[model samples]
Target: PFRSTSLPSSILRSVQLCIQLVSILIFVRVLRSKSMEEYSYTMEMHQSQISDRSMRFVGRLVQRRTMRWETIRRWFPSMVE
Candidate 1:
């Protein structure tokens, strides 16, 4: 009769161990998900920086082209005179 009671107690302990292990696994998964979100946010920030730089480069290129065209137009009248 003592052995029978001890067997039930062991079974309950095993159940508790299993529950603890499952909870740990769930916690690790939650941490990994949060890390992924942070990585994606960082990547988005880098992309925005690259886009802003490209836009500025394009604007500068356009301004230089217009300046050169005006200079050429002003010199053409003197050259033809």
Candidate 2:
């Protein structure tokens, strides 16, 4: 009884952690490959373009309504902050 319950919970926690790590790595790669620096006085518009492109690429498989920000918030603590 207890064994079954605890095992699944522990496994789920590990899986979630792995996914979060992969997401972070992918995020960094996308930023670096695009050579995106902090938006400057004249590059403010570019920031939004970059953000939109990143979001589309990373979140393509994830359904907006199903796995919304709230759901990922649980796995990625930094995202909440």
Candidate 3:
């Protein structure tokens, strides 16, 4: 009768430990995945901002080129005609 009672207590302790370990592992995995998602989102935002700036720079260059050509045409209309 004494051995049977002690055996159940030991088994219960081991079961509790196992449950604690499993819950910890699950929590760590969730945190890792959330960090990865945030990292990817930040990277995407940075890339889009870089692309937008480059596009604006290109637009400015094109406008400058067109304005120079127009000035040349105005200064020497006979040459273009």
Which 10 consecutive residues of model 1 have the lowest summed lDDT? 34-43
Ranking by lDDT: 3, 1, 2
The ten-residue window of minimal lDDT in model 3 covers 34-43
Off by over 4 Å in 2: 1-7, 35-81
TM-score of each: 0.34, 0.35, 0.34
How do the residues 1-81 of candidate 3 rate in per-residue lDDT, one tens digit apiece? Answer: 446555787798998899878756654654465333333333343444556776556445544566665676689767644
- By the TM-score metric, which is better: model 2 or model 3? 2
lDDT for every model?
0.54, 0.49, 0.56
lDDT by residue (tens digit), candidate 1, 1-81: 446555787798998899878756654654465333333333343444556776556445545565555566578745422
- What is the RMSD, in Å, between candidate 1 and the native fold over all Cα? 25.4
> Highest lDDT among the candidates is held by which one?
3
Local distance difference test, candidate 2? 0.49
lDDT of 2 at 5: 58
- Expressed as tens digits, the lDDT of each residue in 29-62 for candidate 2 is 6455432221121134233556567655443433
Q: Tell me the lDDT of model 1 at 70.
A: 57
What lDDT would candidate 1 get against the real structure? 0.54
